[model samples]
Structure formats: C-alpha cells, structure tokens
Target: MSKKKSFPLRLDPELYEILQKWAADDFRSVNSHIEFLLREAAKKAGRLKKSQE
Candidate 1:
C-alpha cells in the first residue's frame, strides 16, 4: 500500500451538505467519495498513474 497524505479541507456549508447526502446515497464515507471522484477525474484526464495493486 502507498502512504497517504492528509491535509485540512474547507468546504462551504451548503456544498458539504450536498456531499454528505451524495456520499450517503453511494454508501461511502465523505472522504472516500471525494477520493473516488478525484480518482475518476484524474483517470478521465489521463493523469492517473498505474497503481501497484
């Protein structure tokens, strides 16, 4: 497994609420859902490196 980096994130209250609802709908924690979205976006842009899994 790769080491994961952590950082502080600030979101507008309304946006956070939306993300919470979406995450719940997808059966994912907000953090996982955000990472999923980011990974998908990176893949779509051809910017994701091949994983070592």
Candidate 2:
C-alpha cells in the first residue's frame, strides 16, 4: 500500500455529528468514511487517475 497523506480538516459541529453517525452506520472509522466519500467524488469527476490506483 502507498503511504496515505495527512492534513487537518475543519467541520461544522452539526456536520461532524452527521458524519459520525454515517460512519458508524457504515461500520467505518470517521476518517476512513471521509476518505471513501472523497475518493468516490473524485472518481465521478474524473480527477482520480488510474495510475494512482
């Protein structure tokens, strides 16, 4: 596996609560859930390269 990059994220309290719930429902850690969502979005936008896989 490639090294994962890290960065600080800021979220509104309400949004954080929503994400926490969603993550739990999906059986994913909050950070992993966020990454999954972002990856899906980038794939949809054609911003994620196959080479990066």
Top-lDDT candidate index: 2
Write model 2 residue lDDT over 1-53, tens digit each, in one string.
88999999999999999999999999999999999999999988999999854
Model 1, range 1-53, lDDT digits (tens) per residue?
67889999999999999999999999999999998888899988888888711
Error at 28, model 1, angstroms: 0.5
Using TM-score, give the best candidate's number. Answer: 2
Residue 2 miss distance in model 1 (angstroms): 2.3
Error of 1 at 34 (Å): 0.5
Candidate 2 deviant stretches above 4 angstroms: none
Global lDDT scores for all candidate models = 0.89, 0.94
- Candidate 2 local lDDT, residue 4: 93
**What TM-score does prediction 2 earn?**
0.89
Quote each prediction's TM-score. Answer: 0.86, 0.89
| Clashes in predicted model 1 | 0
